[model samples]
Target: MRRPDVLVVGAGGSGAALAARLSEDPGRTVLVLEAGPVPRFPPGFPAELRDARLVPGAWPDAPTVRAYPVRLTPDLPYTAVRGRVLGGSTTVNGGYFIRARREDFDRWSARAGDARWAYERVLPFLRVLETDLDFGATPVHGGHGPVPVGRTGLGHPAVEAFRAAARELGHPDEPDKNAQGVPGVGPVPTNSAGGERINTGTAYLLGALGRPNLTVLGDCSVRSVAVERGRATGVVADRNGRRTVLEAGEIVLCAGSFASPHLLHLSGIGPAKVLTRAGVPVVEDLPAVGAALSDHPQVVLEWTPRRPVAEPAGSWLGGALHLSSSGGDHPGDLEILQSLVPMAGLVGRRTAVPGRPLALLASVQTPRTSGRLRTVSADPRVPPRIDYGYLETADDRRRLREAVRAAAALLSTSAFGEVSAGVVEPASLDDDGLLDRWIRSRLGTSQHTCGTVPMGRAGDPSAAVDGHGRVYGVSGLRVADTSILPAAPLRGPAATAVLIGELIAHAMCTVR
Candidate 1:
């Protein structure tokens, strides 16, 4: 085997896209190492991964799901379902592929001090990643690309009721949910086609499979980045219990949000205290490696159906409505997503609802409260401690209160009344104290985690990576994944993760 020009860590959504895009130039050999199993071709994937609708831990549980135990509020212990396969979470995600809004990029650009982070500048890259089946002709959408995107599960009666109720509440219909769409009700643009989950490993890496310049190795977990002096030389990895040293000209960490920071902590590139506690030699005391944790905190509002509805045949999610919590303060700050069918067995029996519950997941998009991701042990096999400080601030609780209030109003509408009998338990939005407590009790993740390794300029003590996705205090190394995002975008991070990989690859190619 030849030494690769670029060694991408973790063949998830970002890593797969970066590796495949880098290999476009046959001269530069690209290699990707994924902790989970990855197949060379689409057919090599399992049947569970083929369906775009079935989330691994959702109702009628499917295989190939890995759950990491984390604390939602220190009091609330939750297990986050993550995809351990080649495509990362994309292979198992519900396929919500909505792009981050312009406001989101404005924050990114300002934080990173780079014009390339501007929404307009990054728009072209997003267009090149997906072939939108619904809105391809649109100027903002891509007509020919690797990933296939379209709308599904909208035909359900519950989905229709949710849309009608939102319209009744005066929320206008914004059909296009991509970059061009406004904050309103519409079908969610998903990266699913023909009932199959067309994830990055299958979409972006499909062509690079047999290419001479690219090699994707799965079941190979990188324990740490081998940083010699100030440059990243390679990685210390274990492939099925056998440890080995792999060298590359440049290294890229694309291990998503949770694992990427964990890798950095293990590599002794984080806070000195963490390194000392883990008993690892501190290489660089970058205190920002696992700081500023941001996630979309979600609270679900359920309604028992007036007339019983069957289990949904397609995707659980169909339509979503975006709103501003504080008018004009934050655009698209509140996302009221509809789960058309109840996740009866999503979490053992805890998710079981009465009368086929129709759920509306109210997620606080722009949360003011941030948390921390810390290392508790040196062993890479042991997961890190995640302290999600959700609803810790009065402002965050206020935003979530508004979302719950909005969702409750939608469920009470006549359109919803036709389908819903009444709101179930925790409909206590009448009192501010009760509503605040409700927000705390139900606080959960939208599965969109970011901001651990924030993108900022040099001398910013709170930053871990730079605008060009390069890690500070390290040479010939970069991180192109969700962890490098300045904050969690208003939309799901699925599309944004792919966009990050594409944008980072373009930047690297330009530099080369």
Candidate 2:
């Protein structure tokens, strides 16, 4: 893996795809470095990591996940956990592989000042990333792709009730959540198969393993990107407790929302004032690096079921309702996701709830609030201070408040009555003041972090990277991850991250 033609940092969701696609050519050499080590294939990983129903990352002692202290609000302290192992968050998530709404790419295209990012322009790449089990070989979805996309394979009584409740409440039925169809209740597209989370590592990397030109090394921590002469040529890493400087013709970072931007800061490719304050020589004074943090600020509503909600052996996230907020310009901006099983064990600590619980996750999909990330200290080990300015705008607060109330209504319907249970927390969301306080106190994140390195045209001072993810002030370096997203997608980012890898990989190949 020495002097690989292409070096991908962080073998998570996007990194796995980037390495897999770039290494397709036998002539191109690729090396992927991951900090967290786990079995690349089945039987090697622990049981909790294998199944999405387990919600492995929430466990206090889980090794594959890194829990970082982040502020969701002024006084609300939260833990923003990011997957550290191969396949990234996909390994630890609930297998909600829903695609980014078409509107998401519209803003991306607008910010980049390029039409190539438009939904129509990017649909083919989207098709290339997934094999849609529900609708295959269609004009909109792919049939033969590396990643397998299926919908609500598990049967849960509550999921059925949730769907029925949506219909009873006059919401349309959206069978395929991945489609460009209208917002409504629908099955959550999952990337799992045979009860195993088929993460990007399994879908893209595993298939291309053993290739002479490809090497994947886990437990290798990249201390900094080696940017010499204002160009990224390689990375200085700690491999097996030894300092190693590995060079590459091109370096791509797919370390996700937080880690990717964090790496750029460590490499001295960030705001001049911040890096100088940290005592690190500036490689590039990119003001936008880690400046515009966008994400979904979500709150959980977990309740105890009438009886012990019989557990099911399937994907935990089975159904969801996407609806527009009152007076909102966007569609499906307010979300209420239904979990097939009790979620008290998963995120109950955030809500101060404990016991077998049925849950509804609500959030404002299009938050106007933008947060910031700053490298407080030069030490690479010292994590950046992430100030997730959640619900800063009155509009965001209103939309999220509506979504939470909608979730309560859904739970009150006869559909939920079948499994009728008592409320777990916030005894009442009766008044606006009380609800707002509850929201701030229990606020959390979907972990769909984006826009740290905003994508825009050259003249735009806020722009850090170009539309193709090339760093503005550096050469031989590119980023293909959720961090490049101008904002969080309406649904989730798992599939979008894969699409980004395929899109950027193709662009890199074309340029070569």
Report clash pairs, candidate 2.
none
Lowest lDDT sum, 10 consecutive residues, model 1, at 345-354
- Per-residue alpha-carbon lDDT of candidate 1 for residues 1-512, written as tens digits (9 for 90 to 100): 77889999988789889999999999999989987887877888877677655565442234455677788886888777777778888987777898888888888899999999999999889889989998674678889989988876566787888889999999988888785566999888888887777888989887778898899898888999999998999999999779999999999999888889989889888999988998878888999988778888898887888886766555657689998887668777899988755755344323224555667889989834387899888898888888778777778778889989998998889998887898885757789998887777777788888999989989999899998889888898899999898788878889999999999999999975
Tell me the TM-score of each prediction against the true structure: 0.95, 0.96
Error of 1 at 82 (Å): 2.1
Could you say which candidate leads in TM-score? 2
Error of 2 at 93 (Å): 1.4
Q: In model 1, what is the error at residue 191, expressed in angstroms?
A: 0.6
lDDT for each residue of candidate 2 in 191-300, tens digit (9 for 90 to 100): 97766778888888887887999999999998889987878889999988799899999999998889888899999999999988877789889999988888898888
